[model samples]
Target: MHTTTSDTAPEQRTAAPRHPVARAGRISAQGAAALVLVLLLLVVVRLPWAGDLGMHAATVERLRHGLLHPGNPLIDADTPSPYYSPWTLLLGIVAKLTGLSVFVVLRLGALAGLALLVTGVHRYVRTLTAHRAAPALALLSLLFLWGPALFSWSGFLGLNSLALTVSYPSVCALGLTFHFWAWLTRAARGPIGWGAGAGLGVLWAVILLCHQFTGVVATLGGLAMVAGARPARATLLRLGTGLLPGLLVLWLWPYYDFFALFSAGGDLEAVHRSLYRDLAGRFGYVLLGVVALGFRLRRDRRDPLALFFALGVLMVAAGGLTGHYSWGRALPAALIPAQLAAALQAVSAGRWALRRGWACVLLVALVAGAWTQAGTLGYVVRRDALPGAVAAKYREPWAGYQWIVRAGVRYGDVVMARRFPARQIPAYGPYTVAPGYPDVFLPDADRREAAMKRYFEAGTGDGERRAILRAYGARWVVGGAPAPWLHKTAVGPRGQVLYRVAP
Candidate 1:
């Protein structure tokens, strides 16, 4: 299939329009991007509590104290974990050398991740179109092209989601994924040397290790880039040759077993089932991008964006049908190409009438999207201080387990708490009786969870509860109920009490 001029262009041939309206629109998009970037910077400094923040923070804390043999992040177990990726290891090193708190290191990581994401988006979009506005427009589209319903997940690049998970390795992996695509697009156009190919392969593996779900999205995007290029036999050979070292890195990584995650899918399906819920409410706005993708398909039978969208769709659909709901994490692979296509089409459409129509439609969709996620403002601003309208949109963050930590919980001390508190307690350097999140590598996670449950059960005798605490060596407990074996030490913001387990 013949490539479109927009795709093959080495640089933007047309000077930016001097028309007042066009200039204004470009300025508006760029301004919106700048504002969102500033908001994200504030969010990083604030580091609001949300999904997996504690898990990630705990991982960094463990690594800071003991990089070589950092045990399971959430519980008192000497087991390897998937959380100790290259990204976290680097942050851990920084924390150790600088004597920075784990949260401070996380703030730095968030800044780096946000920077990578911005630069990567600009570079990748430039490959798709020469329009000067394409980069800014694409960035805005990626952030605001979803449906009116609010949705936030690690790999999903929606503005609201990015604000919540800016510190996560998933964000860093996604940033690298964009840069990978841009580099691959350039290399596939001509001969690639062995060194470049091998380096590319290593980068790919690093992304997977950082965040396995985003890694799948990266793979799909990379395949789309390669398939669309139809590279020469020698180019293909070099690419395949480079892949070996990358696979080796995955196999040899001492932190965790990268390959074991495939068999571990059964453990994750339950937690990920929500990825399939309210699909239309969460992603319906992407139909505009889908329409734009249709245009690209009509122009080039093997358009990279179309191929990327198809591959993502196939994966997500198979997941929903085959009961492998975890594959829903690959939703970004489908959403991203369509979003970019819409942004590119707005500027590159051949006819003036077509361009005007598409741009206007996109503007409306983006405005609606921004409004839907207005609650994100609460991350940096006080909810009570925000305007009533914005306050209503806000979803409050967790108050955290600092109250427990402040009362003198120390590293490696196991605390018995139910699930919610279990999630946050470890962030402050203590372990919970049960792992707050799924732990594929922890051998006794299930038994630990059952013990925690039985301890809290109304019918359980004090003897069994004490046995449970002793079995896990739990030194503290977070609950309201009083027991003869518990000595209350501190009360939490939500009225939960911290108790020292009597010896």
Candidate 2:
């Protein structure tokens, strides 16, 4: 059924292109300025490159290959994931268009950029609250100083945990925006719009799959929004419907996977081990949010966004105080609501300070503080944003994991490596790993292959290696040095060792 605009003359259709509100155009400049300021303040948050460590890179690479032949085992089917289809579908489209290898880093660049855009969304959402925009922007400015700055030298860069730490807030911001939008429009009697619903669904789904650790904060933020609803049943429907995409993944978590951030017998213990470490990384963020929340609640205390944001920060901070801490990674999912709430307060503070005639002094202080903290922001930006730097890093010799572009790795062979190394290869279904040759193959800790370590060091006999290569199947062994059979050696872009073991 074709629908026309009442078949009215196209010229007579004087409907101007829609803006969220008429003032959006005027405010857009301010919003963009805020975003750029946020982007620039923690300019280093962009980082040295878009973070293409091991598995993250490998997943994109495998997906790239899978696009060419879906059923073909470019990567295996039984990898680990919750089957969150939407983001994976988006990733697949990206893989088909760009291929997996190049996308290894390419995708991270895009992801980091997406993370950065949260500042803009934060600004836009702040616009709704009106009075809170300034401090909200300032708070965002300060947030750039938190994770990346603290973690840049925390010695955990290139690790999944740190990546989760940084990316969680970005995801949280998006969730908060959607939740606020949903609550703001919940009274609409006409068909409840799908725009906010679909958008929130997609973003949260991506967050769930990206790393479940973010669950700590994002979940908190989500509940805050639900609490804002007028009718309990409607709110229940909204929240439940919103989680549909994530539910899909939870159902399929046993089978489909991109990386195993969460799995039985694996690093589940690591999550416990990381408790205090996570708390320390997130201390500054929690503090700032608390202060910002205190200030924002001073005025329009009734706003649900404000209340939820305050509660979340207090809750997480209290948890930290009482040793429930984990950099809130045990709760990063709460990051969205908390930050949104903080942003609301921060913007309010900023506006008040500015309107009260302290705007110039405060803004300068904000920028100066961020600039001093450039070490943090500069890492992510310098890594990938610089021209040719990303490509150059991957071209041959590299320092950080250079955000490189490649067709993708073809992993149809056995891979032999250590605990961490074994974990990184799950995305490549085309390969298996070995230690004692022929018998013990899987290196997954959860897989209970006790002999995995010995396999990497001793599995490389000339004839046996040839036979292992032929029988078990493998194209490359990364980050490991073995005997004569592990032919064709090279260091990875990130300086991890690699061997082009023949399939």
- TM-score of every model versus the real structure: 0.97, 0.60
Identify the runs in model 1 with alpha carbons over 4 angstroms from their true place. Answer: 1-15
Per-residue lDDT tens digits for candidate 1, residues 176-234, read: 99999998887776787999899889999999999999999999999999888777778
In candidate 2, what residue range of length 10 has the lowest lDDT sum? Answer: 1-10
Task: Identify the leading candidate in terms of lDDT.
Answer: 1
Write candidate 2's Cα lDDT for 112-159 as tens digits: 534444444554353244442433343344344244223431112112
Q: Note the Cα lDDT for every prediction shown.
A: 0.90, 0.41
What is the TM-score of candidate 1?
A: 0.97
Give me the displacement of residue 364 in model 2, in angstroms. 7.1
